[model samples]
Target: MPKWTAADVPNQDGRTAVITGANTGIGFEAAKVLAARGATVVLGVRDTAKGSAAAAQIVAASPGADVRVQRLDLTSLDSIRAAADAIRADFASIDLLINNAGVMYTPKQTTADGFELQFGTNHLGHFALTGLLLDMLLPVPDSRVVTISSVGHRMQAAIHFDDLNWEKSYSRVGAYGQSKLANLMFTYELQRRLSGKGKTIAVAAHPGGSRTDLMRNSPLAFRLAYKVIGRLITQAPSEGALPTLRAATDPNVLGGQYYGPSGLGESRGAPVLVKSSAQSHDVAIQRRLWTASEELTGVKFPV
Candidate 1:
């Protein structure tokens, strides 16, 4: 039996994929492999300069690879709308939408819309992006939406409805957990809604433990020092990207399914089907979160 490395990624000819935060780390790795396999990959990042460099790197590796960059600042609704409008105006149908960009532990911060930064960027940003672009995908056969979550979801996570913004108090770790948990719930609920349409499906994936720039802000009740534990337990960014790539391209993946590494506790190994936290599977909470998200972002799904 052969192991599933980036070499195993199926040919993605003629597919158009939009990947947020693709300038580096897992997102960049995913874009590189997909582009090499013949997909027209879009690197969605907050910095166009970095995005262009990432694009240049991809094209350099796979000479003539169709890859480009688009500015996407998840913390600002204005930026998200601008990005979506740009994408919608050009592409009538989308093959894949990967919500791979996220912010981890950081000092309490607010988005341009005044929401908690982690939740705003990690969940609402992707939620609104998916809704705005869903019409482009729904009419296209077999299009998929993949949201990246995290093992950090299990760390005292919940919606914190009364203070979704953490207005009264702030705990960066708690906010991060809530955001990641919302990622899974959003995927589950979105899958249910999309099931009736049949043209698209929603799936979730987590990097497990990966050495990526996204973790620079880590500080919490980590089992060990954040950087030390990550260095000891994490896999490379390319390996970290497998779950997301598999969730996006695997022909057998079903709506609402999750993908993660196969190593102990799903920290690092070959990508495979994995179970999410039990809370992620709860229907009632998922519905409530969906409504709250729609209200906050003001983007309604066509589904």
Candidate 2:
């Protein structure tokens, strides 16, 4: 059996990929590969200047690459809507929408819409963006909505229905867990809804233990520990992006399937089909989360 690599990505001519937080790390790596393969890549970023810089980098690497940038601040609903509208105005149909941007452990904070920063940016924001743009995808055969989850999802994670905002208490670790878990549940529920609609499928992937700027928000003690042992356990961003690339482009990928590193503890290595926590497969909870997310974000799916 062969391992999947970026080289395995098929020719993507005429495809349009909108990737969130694509200015750096795994998202950037995925964008570069897809662009090189002839996809018109859109870097959806919070900072337009940074987004343009990232797009320039991609075009520089892949000469003649048709790369564009759209300002997308996931922490705010207005920005998400604006980004979606801008994208729909430019491209009539979208082939891929990769929910790749996220925030890691940070001191307790809230989003522009008053939701917890991690949950709002990581799960709810993508939820709204996807719902807004799914209409364009439904009309295009084989279109995909690939979301980026994390191995952290299984680390004491649950959908905190009672205190979804963590207003009672706050543990950066637990909040992050809730958000990532929501990412998986979202994918499963979305796949169920997309069923019998069209060729569009919902998929999830995780960049198992990659060294990136995502950890900039980590506590000093944890950051110090990572600085000491990170190299031994973590893979590069390019390596981390492999699972997402495979999830987005592999023709054999089925809806609701997950991909992650094949190495020990799924920390680092080539991308392959992987299992998520059993809790992530809870259909009732998934439906509940979907309904809750709709209520929280005021975004309903057309599917």
The lDDT leader among the candidates is: 2
Q: Write the per-residue lDDT of candidate 2 for residues 1-303, one digit (tens) a residue.
A: 888889899999999999999999999999999999999999999999999999999999999999999999999999999999999899999999999999999789999999999999999999999999999999787899999999999987999999999899998989999999999999999999999988799999999999899899988998999999999989999999999999999999999999999999999999999999999999999999999999999999998
Best by TM-score: 2
After TM-score superposition, the amount by which residue 219's alpha carbon in candidate 1 deviates from its true location, in angstroms, is 1.8
C-alpha local distance difference test of each model:
0.91, 0.95
RMSD over all Cα atoms, model 2 = 0.7
Query: Per-residue alpha-carbon lDDT of model 1 for 229-266, expressed as tens digits?
Result: 66767899999999999999988889999999999989
Compared with the true structure, the alpha-carbon lDDT of candidate 1 equals 0.91
Which window of ten consecutive residues has the lowest lDDT sum in model 1? 219-228
Pairs that collide in candidate 1 are none
